[model samples]
Target: MYDRFLVSKQIDQWLAEDIGGGDLTAQLMIDPRATATFAMNAREPMTLAGVEVAGLVFTRYEPACRIEIHAHDGATVERGALLMTVSGPAQALLTAERTALNVVQRLSGIATETAKYVRAIAGTKARLLDTRKTTPGLRMLEKHAASCGGALNHRLGLDSGVMLKDNHIAVCGSIMEAVKRARLRVPALTKIEVECDRLDQVEEALAAGADVIMLDNMSLETMRQAVALVDGRALLEASGGIRLDTIAAVAATGVDYISTSRPFQSAPAVDIGLDEA
Candidate 1:
């Protein structure tokens, strides 16, 4: 679970966005003291996430609200499966409904998409890894969902790892020069990875003592050859133009990791509905 205060803060923001100054429908239709019971059920099959986050919303709206979670985050659930039950003031329930469902649905969609990629490379040495192309302000939550779906997270931000991409190489003049400069300036604990688009760059990166080499947009034959050329000196990763249909073949190149941003950026929101019982 995340920090209670932080969760409460997020819930507050969501609630404020949903009910700007008032919830006219709930206030007009229900008694101030009236209470209700409701079960939150999945309208379609999905991986569960943000259960605690959702509960925080209801609890914040109505301090006396009681929430019971039947399905935990990271669990796969079927359509119509009961996820949670809540009892509280009718207005409170109505106020928190959309906010709660929004968090759960978005996070669950990330988890579900991550699960598909993780499953695609099952039984292979290559691990499914996510890139930094995460939703703004939701990176932490989305990465947590990815971990829940069994995918390893790459560098969370630029500061975590040193990756020399094409632009960096162009600015630095050559792969060898970039790797050399990075190696000289970087702390010993930091691992240096160089992105190589051609076999010559691959050789340059390997000769420059790069700890890892990324084969970017290389054909399968070239990737296999690059892997063989690197031997066991540096870790190999394949990136660019990866999809579900082509992941297995990419993994077969014997790369240690495969990175894609599609899972987080292209995932569809999972379907979930909140209703009063």
Candidate 2:
């Protein structure tokens, strides 16, 4: 989740990046004293996520702008739904339009994509999880969008947990060694997860007392085998090769959670427009 202060900081930087020097078109064509109003509308169905953030972007540019939000975050809206309306100095509104739309569109797209995956895995024990594969400067915002779509958040960063992957295992010589080192270094309450692509490694990770075991890219049969092998000794997460087409099947394999980056990495921006009201 993002606080107003944090969101404001990000919006400020984005505005600076976008409107450096000045908005040439707005400055050249619009009178500073002229006022105008615009409505933000959804051009397609989407799970909205950042309506308020969009408001923040607009207000950051012009504090006196009056914004009326018609749709809230996490709302599932149909095409042509009015999302927001803003009225302010014409130049200010025009200058802030793109940044505001960009934030809401991108976040809504991520939320919509996450909702699809969440729906796919419904009626199963497996919970949807968002990965760290987020836009670099927008991890918190992106993760917030994923949560808005009903997916649980995974580790926010490497510091959130100890995840021993192939490289770490290779460096430490084995899963056991890697987990041991991590356990000693991390806080006493921190969980240690080990990524295992093979049943043999799953066994080793279980033996090493890993709190969470990630079944990385294993076949369904193998995943079932791993589930039976672990016997609830550790939480199992399915990762890699997970797609909308195969997510339900993966969930049926009985993993505790399914993790994917597709929702954030490849989700298409939702079509939204801010036009004269």
Candidate 3:
């Protein structure tokens, strides 16, 4: 759902932020007609992502730039694999280098990290999920990378789905009232999920007819009970405190989905660099 219009707009913002008042360094050091080719390669294993958008960064400056994407998104690339090649104006290459590398490295890191979580829950009915914990303006791209790494997207934003969190419940005074109001306000196609931190809240949420029930940071015993309590009435999601070391047990507890913030919030950028080709 990330359209070119949006991507281009964001790219404009990035370029404006990074290249304000012209790239005087490039202006001083480079000739306008100087054309060169650059190759982007991985320094470590990664689930390839952002190649296309990274290409866009170059083209955004030099529209006629030649871009060859050797590795597409979701492809697993080994160390030293060539991800892409760009041949264009020397100034364009220099101007686009940092922004392009930052985007691809950050996104590839997320995709590669998410691959671990996906593999951990493989062969199970439980699906891996990503939360709203994403970079403010880059959620679209980041979520796309998560999907590339094999996790399904949850709510894209607050407007995309009806989710009643702890604060919403606290304000509404009870899960029943919060859900009832949301059910009346939203269309039938929209799913209403409630976040319950306690066992008693789980039953109350179930009774309120929420479409999905999230067990937030519950113990293994409590999660099992929550799944049984759900009993096919709603989709069960386990969130909070999920880690690579702990995700398998959480998945085994019969949660329909496992959500974590690590992929978006904590994944280190992959080491990929651009060099003259």
Candidate 4:
């Protein structure tokens, strides 16, 4: 769940950006005192997300607006399914429609994409993990959408976890040294994860006491080998180039988790529209 106050703040900023000084078109054509009802509907099948945010957008625009949510977040709905309805001053609804639709469409797209990946890896021991690769201000919201589709969030941001990539290892002289330094700097409960591209690096990371070892871009054969080499010594995460087509195979490699950014980074916005009710 999101903090309404914080989300309302964001909605205000977005409304300001989109509405500017005023809604010229709405003002020109719509009666300022007129009241009308509008229904939010899915133009195509999708795993819905941000329905709450959409409601917030309308309420933020006109606090007196009456909203009825027919479908909640994470609901999988078919084409033409009604998601929500709002009745308010015609000008307010018309002005806020685009922003509300944009939020739902974008977030639902991520949820839909993530669901595909989740289904691909079903029955495997591996759980889907979403990466930090998200639109600048929408990381938290996007990750929430991913979770709606059954993928577990990896790290919210850099400060959320310790991930030692290849560059960090290069700077620290070796994986062992890098993990050692990380252990010294971070709290004992903070998990240190090392990205390894080869079996030898995996061995080094495990021996260095890494809590998690990420197998980056490793072949299926290599990933299997890494899993065997790790032998439960550390959590194994298979990342890099993991796609809907390849996720099942990656999950079959016996890794504990599969990390991918495609669900959020490359998803196309789902079709959603607002129509007069």
Candidate 5:
């Protein structure tokens, strides 16, 4: 769960979006004091996430509403499995359902996809990692779900680490120049990673004291050669064109980490449904 303030703010925005001026249907047809119980179910198999956020939605509308989650975060559930049961004012439940389910379903989808990648690389030296291609406001929640699914999160933001990409290299003119400039400008404790698209750049990065080198969009043969060239002087990472079917092969190349945006960006939203109990 995120901070209460953050959750509240998000909930407030969602409520405003949903209600607009008011829930005209609820006001027109439902009694103010009417209450009901509902069950949340998975319409398709998925990993669970955002349970607490869902509870927050219920709380925002009906402060006394009770939510009980039968399935835990990070737990895998089959289709039609009961995720949680909520009892609250009918209007509030109706208002909050979509927003709550939206968060859980999307995040669980990311977690589920990430879990597959993590499982694919099991027993390999390579670690599964997520890239910066995360949803704007939901980065924290998405990354949290990725961690739950057993993938290590890369830099949460640019401030967390110094990663010199191709554009940075182009602007600075060379990998070594970028690394040197970054080292001189940034703090001593800042870890530096340089993206190398070619095997020749690997030696330059290592020589320039790059702590980690990303082998972007390289073939397995090239990645293996890069790893061999690195020779443990710096941590090696393979990025780009990674898919579930291809991750194991990439991991087998002896790289320390494999990063991709697929788990967060391309994952289909896990199906979930709300049913009146």
Candidate 6:
């Protein structure tokens, strides 16, 4: 669950950026005292997310705006399903409508994409994990949507975990050195993961006491060999170029986690529209 205060703060900042001086168009057409009702309907099937957050956006604009949500996050709704209704000052509803819709549709897109990856790896030992490739200010929200779609989150940010990628290895002399330095300062409970691009590095990382070893872009045959080499010494993560078409195979490699940024990169927004109710 998200903190209500933080959500309100974020919505307020968004409204500030969008509304600026005033809603000149709304002022030109609608009376400040006029009241109107609008209903949100899905234009296609999608795993809904951010419905409540969208409702909150309307309320931030006009506390009197009454928002009724029929579908909650993670629910798959068919075309024409009513998601919510907002009624209040016509000007306020019109002012907030675009922002609210944008939030809902964007999050729904991420949820739908995540669900596809999740379904692809079902019944496998591997769990679908979302990466940090998220919108600038919407990482938490997008990850929440991914969670709704049954994908696990990797690291929330750099502070959340220790991930020694190739760059770290390039700078630190070796994966062993990077893991050693990270282990020295990271909290006792913090997990240290090393990204290995080859079998030799995988062996080095495993021997260096890495809590998790990410096999980056390894072939199926290579992954199988890595799994055999690791022998369950560390949790194996298969990442890089994991897609719906290839996810099942990656999951079948016996890795514990399959991470990808594909869902966050190009999740097409679900179609939704607001109509006069």
The candidate maximizing TM-score is 4
Whole-structure CA lDDT of model 4: 0.94
TM-scores of all candidate predictions against the true structure: 0.92, 0.96, 0.97, 0.98, 0.94, 0.96
Q: What would the per-residue lDDT of candidate 6 be over residues 1-277, giving only the tens digit for each residue?
A: 4677888999999999899999999999898889999999999999988999999999999999999999999899999999999999999999999999999999999999999999998898899889999989899899988987888989998899999999988999998899899999999999999999899999999889999999999999999999999988899999998888999998988999999988889899989999999
Against the true structure, candidate 2 reaches a TM-score of 0.96
What are the runs in model 6 whose C-alpha is more than 4 Å off? none
Candidate 5 lDDT: 0.88
Q: Give candidate 2's whole-model lDDT.
A: 0.94
Lowest lDDT sum, 10 consecutive residues, model 1, at 1-10
Candidates 4 and 5 compared: the better one by lDDT is 4
Model 3 error, position 124 (Å): 1.5
**CA error at residue 116 for candidate 5, angstroms:** 1.4
Candidates in order have lDDT scores of: 0.87, 0.94, 0.93, 0.94, 0.88, 0.92
Q: Looking at model 4, report the run of 10 residues with the lowest lDDT sum.
A: 1-10
Q: What would the per-residue lDDT of candidate 2 be over residues 169-255, giving only the tens digit for each residue?
A: 998998999988888878989999999999999999999999999999999999999999999999999999899999999999889
Candidate 1 whole-model C-alpha lDDT, 0 to 1: 0.87
lDDT of 4 by residue, 221-249 (tens): 99999999989989999999997998999
lDDT of 3 by residue, 1-277 (tens): 3677799989989888999999999989999899999999999999987889999988987797999999999999899999999998999899889999999999999999999999999988899999889999999999999999999999898899999999999999999999999998898799999999998999999999998999998999999999887898999999999999999999999999999989999899999999999
When sorted by lDDT, best at the front, the candidate numbers are 2, 4, 3, 6, 5, 1
- Top candidate by lDDT: 2
User: Which residues of candidate 1, in runs, are more than 4 Å off?
Assistant: 1-7
Error of 3 at 31 (Å): 2.1
The local lDDT score (0 to 100) that residue 33 gets in candidate 6 is 88
Per-residue lDDT, model 1, residue 28, is 93
